[model samples]
Target: MVFVTAGALDGPLLTATLRLRADHAPPGTRSRVFAVGAGLEITAATSGTALAGAAAGLPAPVLLLAVAASHAVAGLLHPVLRGTARSPAALSEATSASRRVQ
Candidate 1:
């Protein structure tokens, strides 16, 4: 049930965020945007798990509400940050280029 809800919410949010990031971020910054987004995702997942674990003593309803609230916050924030789209050639060039370093 949790996976189902998470997938339903996260799938579209991830798609839109990636599309916007590709559309709004500057050429020189796209890689950095991707890197930062990836890092945040990892951190969020880790933090959420730890928080949930630490809250294990709470009632199931309260824990669920907390999880939902966190997801809501993430959903609300996603659209406020946007990125620029790379042109086909630029994307191709980026793909052929060596990985970008932070």
Candidate 2:
């Protein structure tokens, strides 16, 4: 049931992430950008699965805590990283740079 719920939630998140990536990718390099993004996602998932398999001997509580901590860290970092990328100056510079490239 938990796995099913997680999978259901993951679908929309993945869709939105891919859409966001596609929207921001430079015009001529959209395909390349998507390829790279997909490659990275695959690599991350594979690495995570491998890590979990290696850690299978750990206590369930420990494993669950580790997962929770990782999610907490990511949630905290998201705002900081996003703010940096979406700042007014950063956005203006990116826009001008993309315009210049065209």
- Best lDDT among the predictions, by candidate number: 2
Top-scoring candidate (TM-score): 2
Off by over 4 Å in 2: 1-7, 86-102
What are the lDDT scores of the predictions, listed in order?
A: 0.80, 0.86
Q: Determine the C-alpha RMSD for candidate 2 after optimal superposition of all C-alphas.
A: 3.1
| Candidate 1 overall lDDT versus native | 0.80
lDDT string for model 1 (26-61, tens) is: 677799989998899899899988987889899999
Clash list (residue pairs), candidate 2: none
Residue 6 C-alpha lDDT in model 1? 88
